[model samples]
Target: MSAPKIKCPTCTRVIEYSDQYPHRPFCSERCKLIDLGEWASEKHKIEGNSIYDDLLSDDLEQPD
Candidate 1:
């Protein structure tokens, strides 16, 4: 059997999904870092409220 192929999430570069590619889903460190930057900068976000949202609201509502 051959290694499975996948596209890098950042650049959409087709790559082999195997140990040879350390950044399997990304193709290179650059692409991996780019994706990380997007998340760190809030460019990418999961669609839904975070659990901490309720906790933070509760904290704000309490008298200090």
Candidate 2:
């Protein structure tokens, strides 16, 4: 059987989902970094509240 094929999340380029591609979901390091940059810049986010939200808020509300 042949390795499965997938699209790179950043550029939508078709690639093989195999060990040959170190960046499995991405076509290359550049694409991987681009995705990471988007996340770091808050351009991409997972919907819904984070588990640490309440804990962080409580800590912030406390007197320093």
lDDT of each: 0.91, 0.91
Q: How would you encode candidate 1's per-residue C-alpha lDDT over 1-64 as one tens digit per residue?
A: 9999999999998999999889878899999999999999999999988888977875666765
For 1-64, candidate 2 gives per-residue lDDT tens digits of: 8999999999999999999899878999999999999999999999987888967776666765
Clashing pairs for predicted structure model 2, backbone only? none
**Runs off by more than 4 Å, candidate 1:** 56-64
TM-score of 1: 0.80
